[model samples]
Target: MRVVSLHSPAKVSGISTAGARLSRLPPPHEPWTPLLIGRALTDEIVRDTPLHDAPGLALCAWPADMSPVGQVLLVRERLRELGARVVIPNDLYHGFVAAALDHHRGVRVGAWLHAEHHDGDELFERCAPISDAWRCVSERGLARALRVGAGLDIPPAGEICPACVEVPPACAAPSVDGPLRLVYAGRLEKHVKRVMDLALLADELDARGVSFTLWVAGDGPARLDLARAMDTHIRAGRVSLLGPVAQHDMPALLTSADTLVLVSLSEGMPTTVMEAFACGRIACVTAGCGGAVPLIEHSGVGVVVPTGDMRAMAAHLARFAADR
Candidate 1:
């Protein structure tokens, strides 16, 4: 199957990594064609790639900053031209439905939802008119979708399509020989990822007399706060901010640390968490991270703390220090 993937231009940097991993899937022979937007002339890259062929399928992902109505129109037009089906978020489909007073473009519509808010049932009921199939990444996601679809009177056309881990194998695991090392490997932001929780954990660890090292990867608005917090730690030789490292250098960073950490306030199954797991490195995650916690717990691959709970975080750090 030829699948056309829609994602933001920011993620285009990792296309080679994503494509390489997808190509290795023992499969129904499905390959991906990534369609990136939100960058300068990204259409050129899309047109030049081998994925522009006809008779393919389209998969829209990363619901952030998405305009479902505009995306649906684009998807509909592209599907008609390529003879491909359109798969997108239920939210996107709802937008399409609103603008589609003229009727949907008659292409099969699938909802690929990974997470939901408490009021998702009400939100999804709003899309009964346009969705044909539904896919959720986890059992919780499936339940939420079902409840919402049922409430909306949009009986699903089939069973759920579970989300899979798309993380690539880290070439090596970080060696745990020196100071207790903890690394955060995703974008550093406040609204979504609870990066502040990590900062607090560092403070807690220091106050508790725990000797360790903290390495932060990626960059964002939180850099200044992280910098202020790291000064004392850096002076004490306890923390180091590597800034935004390239995606390809991630495995090396991952393998360099004894453990990985993320205190996200919300997530749709973070790719970084999966990469940490795949590297066989233990992780320290917050409850705000959905779905993947169960996998982490089931695999005995890491520790989970209540969202924003620095006390619990400190305790976990103590454990890691003891074991180390």
Candidate 2:
């Protein structure tokens, strides 16, 4: 069956990366087409082109400036033209559109839970009546979905589809005598990502005299602010911003670091952490990083500190630096 994965346009984000990978699946799996909405057709990134190197997986975008009814109508028309049998909406707006069109147009609607947020809960609740299926990025998300389903008297049928990355051949581990190499690869957003907290962590580490280097990758609206916040560290060569690294280059970037750091205010499951693991690196994440907390605790491969505890994070880094 032809499936359409609907999401917003993001240059370097988990949703965009996952959508691009889904679109590249070889035969035997259902073919997926990624459609980016809520952006203007004239936007430079909205062009109808294959996303990255994914063959036949053209990226499509639609404008969001239209009226709600008009947006729904346009989506319906486009889906009909694309002959989409299954519609997987990754965001709330598109989820509503798919929910509205599911029964009316005989298309199967699947709600995608990529994060643990009120918006995700609201989408599940609103679309449960008509949603044919649901998938979540982490076990926490799946459990939440099940809880919601139980409350609504719906059957628990959500699937856990965690984010993935290709594991390359293991590279030689970095020298233990050198400074601890830490990296953060994700959108540099302040709200959910808590990037400003990362700045504070940098300050804590510097104040503690920890021998470490932090490489921050990716870009977002808060990039300028984060840069300003880390100005001292950046000038001191302790922090480097490698803005918006390409997907293909991620494995090397991850392998170069000894530990991956994520101090997000929230997450469903971070692909960056998975990529770091794939590259044989440990992680040091905050409790607010969602599913990663338990994974790290149980697996004993990483460290987890309470959310916003920059001093604790710095303490751990200092220990790693001194012990290594």
Candidate 3:
């Protein structure tokens, strides 16, 4: 049998590399294939398209951003074309698979969870109907998968895939300085990311006579508000708003600062924290945010403060900054 896996080829170089690696494997008894489709799946789709040389089952990473519904439709159609079953990387895909199964009954759909998180239950409840099997990356993730399946009112029947930690190559250490080098990166928006706390913390530092240089690395709806809060610093060059740096530049950007801070109210295992850990930098993150609690405790990599507690967060930043 030939297996085919599908995902977007744009904006996810990591996945593309992994897909290319997985695609070269000889067809297993239960074949698998990786297909990069949808918008921007290739640099020049008309000229250079990477095609699978064999046949097999189709696995998916669930690229449902724009035209999410259409992607599901296409997957369903392709399954019919190959007379093969559908496989998914996570419960996020279960929802899409459920929708596809609603339109095309008798199609086999399965799940392969990459991590264990509290959101497992929610995902299964929303998309476990077409799921005929389950898979996970670790024993913990498998336990979560079992719980998720049970919560979906389904019996357990899944496998565990080996887990791989994404560690970065060894790099030079970050520079420590007297003036606290506070940095905040990621989306800049009050309604969604609520990253305004970075600016407020900078203002508090100014008020408390603590010298610091705040680096803001993105632009969003909250930029004006953050700018207004530190108008003087913005003009004096103490606070720099370098809008939208590339992902590859993140290591250099983070290593330049003494402490990496994120005040986001919501997230899902933010890669920022991982990136910080890989960079060997400490982080000041929001407590009970997404699933960072374990990482914070296990790695001794950083601190976790209550969401929107500017005073407490500022205090922690002060200590961390002073230590550096």
Candidate 4:
């Protein structure tokens, strides 16, 4: 039941969050190990991981000093030594390596995919065929996997696994009120998130004389654009950029708001929708938000509009304002 996940050096930041998620699941008969590429794991990482000092199971990190092919070979050999039954890789190249390990040795290979647009196009075409199965985190991702005819079921990794969830059935009824409390809790990026749509929506709401507060939470390369686009609103006290909320503090931010607004151009199932639904907040999302449309339709947890449709977005905002 031993499983090893391959991760790049840049994957360290999510270590604690991943560890927290893993700790919530039932541990397998054998300990699950996360195989990361690094010279050494920081004390902070070890301290955050639940199984850091587990009796039999421990963390594993290898040095980053080999060619891509050489590293793959090393990882393959190491997995053999550790008696690892399964390998999970995040990207195509690594998935190819996992497939190689499966072909060379008797190892199960699966991919952890989270994006729909990427998964639908190049990613699935390149990686899904090579891997035995996809541990898709979103319904859209799963459909894309099915489109490529990759296996749908996640291998029973026993312990090492990604958290895959379908559209939840129930949602908390929204407070739905005057001066609607709207919030956007994700990257303020122009490319993927289309944060500009939000700014436009704000302008439309403002022009229509809607009394509302739209809090933009999160920071990224497009923060300046967002600030520029909504400067007047920020000064007018209609929008406020919270700037990089820690994951733990998200619940408070979500709960305080009446609805979560996301006008993303493309996405997997965003957790903001789930968080909003759990807090009795409807998620007003874009069609580009992958599986969110289905979730919104089925669960009544949110509303979905087409990507980059400012008029439609404004209409929804107006409707919400009217309802409130």
What's the TM-score of every candidate structure?
0.74, 0.92, 0.64, 0.73
Among all windows of ten consecutive residues in candidate 3, which has the lowest summed lDDT?
Answer: 46-55
Q: Which whole-number lDDT from 0 to 100 does residue 292 have in model 3?
A: 56
Ranking by TM-score: 2, 1, 4, 3
Q: Which residue segments of model 3 deviate by more than 4 Å?
A: 1-71, 78-95, 98-123, 132-151, 155-166, 218-230
Q: Against the unseen true structure, what C-alpha lDDT does each candidate score? A: 0.60, 0.78, 0.59, 0.65
Q: How close is candidate 1 to the true structure, as a TM-score?
A: 0.74
TM-score of candidate 2 against the unseen true structure: 0.92
Against the hidden true structure, what lDDT does model 4 obtain?
0.65
Q: Kindly indicate the candidate among 1 and 2 with the higher lDDT.
A: 2
Clashes of each: 5, 0, 15, 0
Candidate 1 lDDT by residue in tens digits, 1-324:
233344442322222234334434565666544443332334554443323222232333324565656655555555445443443433334323422332354445455564556544554566545556555655666666676666455645455444334445435645546678888876667767767677788889988888788898766678788788677777887877787665556767777777888887765556667777666678888877766677787888888888889889888878788776
lDDT (Cα, tens digit) per residue for candidate 4, span 1-324: 666665443311233234333433464443345554434667665543433433333344556676667666666666677677766665536535744556656787766665677534566566655566667666666666666654433332222233422233444444556578888977667888788888889988888888889898876678898899899999999899988565556667777778888888877667667666656678888888876788888987667888888778778878877876
Worst 10 residues of 1 by lDDT: 8-17
Residue 74's lDDT in candidate 4? 62
Candidate 3 per-residue lDDT, tens place, 1-324, comes to 333455443332223333444555544434356554454433354122223222332333334464777766665666556555454433346234633564455555555554444465566565555566655544555555566666455546565553222355765676576678868876677844577777677777777677788788766567788878778888877799887555556778777877788887655455566666777788888763444556686777788888787777778777766776
Error of 2 at 99 (Å): 5.7
Give the top-scoring candidate (lDDT).
2
Steric clash count of candidate 4: 0
